[model samples]
Target: MVTVDHLVKDYGTLRAVDGVSFTINKGDILGFLGPNGAGKSTTMKMITGFLTPTSGTVTVDGLDVSKNPIEVKRQIGYLPESSAAYPEMTVVEFLTYVAEARGIRDPEELNSRLADVIVNCHLDSVKYRAIENLSKGYRQRVGVAQAIIHDPKVLILDEPTDGLDPNQKHEVRKLIQAMSKDKAIVLSTHILEEVEAICNRVIIIDQGKVLVDETPAEFKARIPGASIDEVFRDLTKGSALA
Candidate 1:
């Protein structure tokens, strides 16, 4: 389980995140929704221990993130918003580097893992292509493949389906759903229907605060016939966040 208690982050005079708290249990897929610059990425970063909370604590399965960063990171896999990668390296080279960095030292084991990821992510055709030479959709797939090469217990994905076609999005969603049975997954997305389609629970935040946290059915049930976007606007239109 991932437990966040009273989390906060500040940038000079601006508060990027303020007193946010939530728990994501195993086998849960939590969809984090917020407007642009509303601190969705910041919260995810803090949860994955990429950024420290200014005040509160984040604990993953009982290990405090700040106190045991390495251990916490060992159990989690993160895909950042930028999908950062070694642009100079081919997909094969890049994934190999990632698998090694993840401590898969046995050559045979590494190759076996790579083979599975290539097929799982449908990267067989582009596996030999340079990351910089791949299309945006292919690059996104490469990013995802690297994040899951080690198959950590927790998954943090920021815009996991960004820049994908309809088919690509469906493929990624299925991968997530299949993985959700074992891992605690947190995904931040601007796509409302995507959340409704896959996420069992949803969180809507604005102005660095959580305005809604409930099941997708309950969230929509708040106003009969209203879409997720309508509920989001109603809850988040109160103030400009960020």
Candidate 2:
């Protein structure tokens, strides 16, 4: 459902993403792994039409991201790294605003979508509380809730379970897995265990380029008797971590 072809992003003289190409089909949950400043977020931004690419192309369901930005964005649900939200708004209020912004004008539809995401993200307890009053984990859930509120065809998540507790992380992973059957997901994360738990495919990028693209099992098979972290370090040892 998503295709990235030779995507490149440059900021002045610095090349953030270089000739990165990948395709994600329905039911594919791609674990986008890289060290600090590895171009993962930059590539995602270009794909989501948040940033213009210096070269190459990104398409969502046959619509070019740059050429048909609004239509393409309509098909994508993006949860950026910061998970920025209005701290003053209550959970329900914030989500309602987002739902309307995404074009859910019908009151019945808006309420139904709101209800679905609240239950799915386990935010029922804090639905009426202001966002600033919630814990980091709960706030993160709110971010996920807003992203899925529109139920877009593609999900691009950065550090999806960043501040969640172990149980909360597991719950989020299960939710991602349950939604994968109908959507193309790009999940960027540092935790290898999270990838092994929920991602069917892994793509490791470094220094603005893709280094390894394969299944998690296949990636581990490359270095037998080694932990995932050990393998990751071995693969990226030469590149300076930003």
Candidate 3:
């Protein structure tokens, strides 16, 4: 449901993302892997229509992200690396604002969506609490709740599990996995175990280019017996100096 073609993003002379291309089909959970500054986030921003690429194209559900940004956005839910919230707003109030902003006018549907996301993301305890008063994990859940509030066909998550404890991480992973049953998900994270647990496919990138795009099992098979960490090191070895 997502396709990126020859995508390139240049910052002056630096090519943050160079000719990176990939496609994610329906119900596929793609694990986007790369070291710091490896263009994973750059590619995601382009796909989500958050950042415009210097060249090439990104399409979501056949809609060109550049040409039809609003339509593309309407079909995709995005959770960036860091959660942005109104510190003073309660969880319910924050979500209400998001729903309104997304033009969700059906009061019944909005209420149902709010309840489902709050329960699914385990935000009931803080449902009435101000966002600034909640812990980091709860705040992250709020961010995710807002993203999926519209029930988009695609979900783009950047570092979704960042800063969470093991239990919280597991819960969030389960949520993502469940959501992927009907929606295409592209998630970028440094956590290999998270990928192994939730992602159906893996795409490893280096220096803004795709190095390996394969199923998780096929990715593991490449090293004959090595762990994902080992495979990653082998693929990215000497890349920094190149």
Candidate 4:
């Protein structure tokens, strides 16, 4: 449901994303892997219409993100790495604002959506608390909740389970797996185990370019008996060796 063709993002002389291309179909959860500042988020921002690409294109369901940003945005939900939110607003209040901003005006729909995210993100216990008062895990959950509040067909999550206990991480993985049956999901994560567990396909990038794109098995097979970390290191070993 999403296609990125030759996407490039440049800031002056520095190129952050270069010729990145991929397609995500329904039921496909693509594991976007990269090291720090590897342009994963930059590519995602372009896909979500948050940042205009220096060149190339991101299209969602036949709508060009650059040409029809608003419409394309309606088809995608994005959770950036930081999960920034209005610190002073309570969870309910912040979500209310998000719903309104998303143009979800029907009161019934708003309430239902709110309930769905609260449950999905396991935020029922802290739904009434102010965002600033939340712990990092709760804040991450809140970020997730807001992203899915609209239930867009495409989910782009960066570090979706960044701050949480192991149990919480597993719960989030289950949530993602459940959601993947109907949506096209792209999640950038450092946790290889999470990717192996939840993602159907994997795409690894480095130095602003895609280095490997394969299924988990396909990738693992390249380095027989190696863990994902080992194979990953092997694939991107040049920079480290340099």
lDDT of 4 by residue, 1-242 (tens): 99999999999999999999989999999999977778888999999999999999999999999999999989888999998899999999999999999999899999999989998899999988999999999999998888889989999999999989999999999999999899999999988888889888999889999988899999899989999888888877765421
- Tell me how candidate 4 scores on lDDT: 0.91
Residue by residue across 1-42, what tens digits does model 2's lDDT show? Answer: 999999999899999999999999999999999889899999
Off by over 4 Å in 3: 239-242
Question: What residue pairs clash in candidate 1, if any at all?
Answer: none
Find the candidate with the highest TM-score and give its number: 2
Comparing candidate 2 with candidate 4, which one achieves the higher lDDT? Answer: 2
- Residue-by-residue lDDT tens digits, candidate 3, 1-242: 99999999999999999999889998899999987888998899899899999999998888999999999999988999987989999999999899888888799998999999999988998999999998888888999999999999999998887878899899999999888989999988878978888899999989899999999999988899899878888889876521
Backbone clashes in each candidate structure, one number apiece? 0, 0, 0, 0
Comparing 1 and 2 by TM-score, which wins? 2
Q: Which one wins by TM-score: 2 or 4?
A: 2
Q: Report how far residue 118 has shifted in candidate 1, in Å.
A: 0.9
lDDT for each candidate structure: 0.91, 0.94, 0.90, 0.91
Q: Write the number of the candidate with greater lDDT, choosing between 2 and 3.
A: 2
Give the per-residue lDDT digits (tens) of candidate 1, residues 27-75.
9999999888788999999998999888899999899999999999889
- Summing lDDT over every window of 10 consecutive residues in candidate 4, give the lowest-scoring window: 233-242
- Model 3: lDDT of residue 82: 88
Higher-lDDT candidate among 3 and 4?
Answer: 4
